[model samples]
Target: MNAVDSALCEAFAPSGVLRVSINFGNPVLATRGTNGEPQGISVDLATELARRMDLPLRFVTFDAAGKSVAAVAAGDADFGFFAFDPVRGKEIAFTRPYLLIEGSYLVRSESHIQTNDDVDRSGVRLAVGTGSAYDLFLTRELKHAEIVRGSTSPEVVNTFLRDGLDVAAGVTQQLLADAKRLGGLRLLRGNFMVIRQAMGVAKSRGDEVATWLDCFVSEMVRTGVLRRAVARHQIGAMSAPEVKP
Candidate 1:
């Protein structure tokens, strides 16, 4: 049983404050608010979690989920939102995923690639965010297409367009936005993958936070809290699976 009290403060609320990693590049889950503060579904959830724990909330911003993962793993941030990937699993412990986002490819409108099946060819070049979940997945799955890693997620689309790459792979929402903004680009008919969004604490941070966060996330999904945040942030109807019993 988890205690509502700060009996486990050291694990989650170190320094009498809970520092939440805000991955602002993940447009589906986070973005900058009107006031230039971190504002999005993840921010709301993190804030509520801190409130419930009776701790002051502190925001630690990261431009990429990989950076946030590294920060949390290095014990620089208390916890962060991340996609559940085996590669990252080695370094951090993940809670059950509460949200899922589509991962797909975008290509030049005049390109021969019309579907997801066309993306794996020998000459295809895909641009991906270095250390992103899609990059890790494609690095393992893409046998022929070459992957070029940009410095971060938000830069991937520009890197793809600038380099004349065959495809840009990342969160589908980001791809859609790029297609709308950059023009001359379109998303493949189907998704290449589904990114499972979850929270993680560093393995070095101990098992207590992991256990507590797992329960907290499941509750957040089961109740309407997670849904409300999604609606409030206008994050779109990506996908929210019921928490496993």
Candidate 2:
């Protein structure tokens, strides 16, 4: 490889191996296999990036997005997949989004909450995963509602039910599955936000690393690597369109 490429490799794998932070919090990107191994679109992309870099790979796994972000931001891992948020942007240098997943809310079937607008009224208790993208988003946007913190995204529904919160906010697909599994719950009409999922390295890695990561994601989309990975994993979220110049 050329000197510039070698320098990037050394920066990315400073400990002699690429450690990727894999978050199982977002079902669209990753999940545990029957054999208990991490499997999904994020894993496929991380593996491909390592292969292309000719670097040995390792996964630093977490069940929560907040932990994954912390690991990468602290330089405990070389890379991570996360929903792009301005709050997180302080520590992570993110690529343009590769996936667009809807952020939605779920409510009990008999609850008076009827629409997305109704969710923002006073006295409404909304449960959200602590430090999730939507939690951060809603924390900034919701004017009157109270946001109750769940330990992780997957547990948002449980927290909502356990605390008797009025709504559970999270990824649409995950909430849909939770509503189906537990019953008596319905999603609020439409979505509250569209989560822009992307790969990131710590800002400490420098602008060059962020630029290269963006190029890598763009090439994956152009060559249909992302398309195939989504199809292979049976993810329901839409692929984000390439950002035009």
Candidate 3:
């Protein structure tokens, strides 16, 4: 790898290890390995980022994107992988997305909700992860349905099951995993939103490293490293985003 700017290095991995907050809830992005190691597309990319920087790697795991974003905002981690959201823009700066995932709704198999459009109806109760991109989106868009909050993204499916929710809104991959693991759960045919998965740092870090991360992600995608990681993770029905201009 080419030498990196020393100042950027100090700013990004001050503790020697490139500390990256990773959300394990999004199955498309990350999951546990056979030996209980962190494993997935994001983990592979984070490892690659550290390797390129010649920094040791440390992953600070979280069950939710909100917690991962909070770690970035609080400067507890050098950076984190999360869905890009305007609400998070207040405290953190995110690079252009390296991946795109779909947001969809899950419902009981017996329900009449065959499409994404069928979910937003009166008396419908939707379970969503608190402070998540899906929650943020549904809060603003679902006029008739009541939004029920789960502590984390992975918990949304549980909440939906326990509460007999009319719909469960979250990452499509997450919904798919739940649908497969649990009986009588199915996803709406189409996605309700396209989630931009990006890396983030505290807003105070300024544009220099953010710009570098943006470029780093693009290079990873262009070089096929990211796409390969996605394939290894078995992330179905998704694609690495086009490099941001």
TM-score leader: 2
TM-score of 3: 0.93
- Encode model 2's per-residue lDDT on 1-245: one tens digit a residue: 22338888888879989999999998998999999899999889999889888888999999999999999999999999999999999999999889999999899999999999999999999999999999899999999999998579999999999888999999999999999999999998999999989999999998888888888899887778888788777778888887842
Better candidate number, 2 or 3, judged by lDDT: 2
Worst 10 residues of 1 by lDDT: 236-245
> For each predicted model, how many residue pairs clash, with residues at least 3 apart or on different chains?
0, 0, 0
- Residue 122 Cα positional deviation in candidate 1, in Å, after optimal superposition: 0.9
Q: Over 4 Å off in model 2, which ranges?
A: 1-4
lDDT of model 2 at position 224: 84
Tens-digit lDDT string for candidate 3 (1-245): 24677888987777777899988877778888888788888788888888889898888988887888888888889988878888888888888787888998889989987887777888888899888888887788888888988568888888888888898888887788889998888888888998888878887887887878888877887787777777776787455667546
TM-score of 1: 0.95
Task: Write candidate 1's Cα lDDT for 1-245 as tens digits.
Answer: 36675567876767788898889777887888789898888888898888778888999998988898888888788899999999999989999988888898988889999889888889899999988999999999989899998658888889987888888888888888889997988888888998889988888777877888898898888887887877777766454677563
Q: What lDDT score is found at residue 202 in candidate 3?
A: 85
Q: Note the residue pairs that clash in candidate 1.
A: none
Q: Look at candidate 3 and tell me the lDDT of residue 66.
A: 81
Give all candidates' CA lDDT scores.
0.85, 0.91, 0.82
